[model samples]
Target: MTLFKTVDATELQARKTAAEEQFRGRKSGIDHFAGNDPVTGRPVGGYVEGGIEAVLVKYAEDLIPVYVEYTTKGYTLTSVGVVSINSSTWEIYMNRPAEQVKPLLDAILQKVEDDYIAEIEVYNNAIVDKAVAEQLAMAERREAKELEEATKARRERIESEVRQGLKAPDLTKPKSGKK
Candidate 1:
């Protein structure tokens, strides 16, 4: 069983206002209407009270583009502006002073760049050291091989001379056949 009653516009509006105030006083953050999601046509969370919605709309219209641009460029919003029904535009404030903030962010970026450059320098130095060590090792090997070849050549020449001296007549040794 269900009961239906018709209420006048003024009475209904008064009741809505009371309800919105009650809910807002008790709750925190944005209040969402059950079936009145602005973007989607479905029910979502709790309902947004009329006053909050108006303020939100005003802020979005004026500052949404600014917020989007800042965020797209990798910046964070530090503060939200005060909302007023009389004002046409919304004002947003930053958490940090512009003078202090810019230098801090720049310093951080500069430090990262410096660290990367230092790492590259270390890697380049390691490469140079490795190349020098390889060159020295190759030179030493070349010298050792040249010395071995020279020694072998000297030994062969000495053996050839001894054989020639033996084959030729020697005054100190007597001949096998008498002259």
Candidate 2:
């Protein structure tokens, strides 16, 4: 007892045609940008910009997959993985439906920007802390100088008062036992 009935040849052909048409229609909605080789103007799939070719090559030393993957339920499409790369431009084949690819790319770009901002914030905090420490040290030095000047002035005032009350003690004179 089979669960499915076999269709006629004509009906099967019609079904195949309909499925292809639907796939083509979905593919048509995606935007394609021309990524040319910056040096030769030859059409290329990807490019690595910013003069850091060695570093990128090192990371991509292994195989880079360009195929697309479907979600577990087959309802969503993952990234249109790396298709090609040239000297400074890269292309992602991403044969994804329009709705899926655009938002995914947007989210990825936003994440990168956010991470960059976080790193900058950490660097900025370090600089700010150093400046604050220097300012505190300067303030302490000023306070110490002010205290030293005040103590010197007080000592001079006390000596002057003693001199005015009694004659200056002679350096050569010996002290008497009786008051």
Candidate 3:
């Protein structure tokens, strides 16, 4: 008989539907399309048909060129081989069933989410650093202005004291006899 368990058309369809449902739930976090449907005015759903390629187009468009290579041994397609997914320079080789497209898409989506979070963190840190630096500079300038004003006030006080001393009568001088 056959080495592998046979999968009927109905079973395959059910598996595909389940996979699509899983994808729909997971895609909510990263879904950028927030437009409403033209016909009903309701929000557009995020489900796309046509297997892995469709999922990639709808969700992971940026991570394009995610190649899936399926190999069949003979004319009857008895022996199905491994699936290779190449995303950019990184290559993932797995022996997963071709019908299970959700797991592969899930992995890519996870990567996208992680990278997005890291980018946001970096941006926030930069803004905080810039704000702190601006505050420090402003404080330094205020301190310098206060110091300059204090020095000027001290100099004016010393000058006024010297002028008062000069204007005062000399005690050692004798009075005029004619007075």
The numbered model that scores best in lDDT is 1
Candidate 3 error regions (>4 Å): 1-104, 165-179
> Pick by TM-score: which candidate is best?
2
Global lDDT scores for all candidate models: 0.54, 0.50, 0.50
Q: Give the TM-score of candidate 2.
A: 0.39
By the TM-score metric, which is better: model 1 or model 3?
A: 3
- lDDT for each residue of candidate 3 in 84-103, tens digit (9 for 90 to 100): 24433322222334445456
**Per-prediction TM-score to the true structure, in the order listed:** 0.37, 0.39, 0.37
Error of 2 at 177 (Å): 18
Instruction: Give a tens-digit lDDT track for model 2, residues 1-179.
Output: 63323334565456445544444333332223337678998776543221011112222333242122222212232244343466554433323444554554455455555655566667767777888999999999999999999999999999999987897887788888998
Q: State the lDDT at 32 in candidate 2.
A: 37
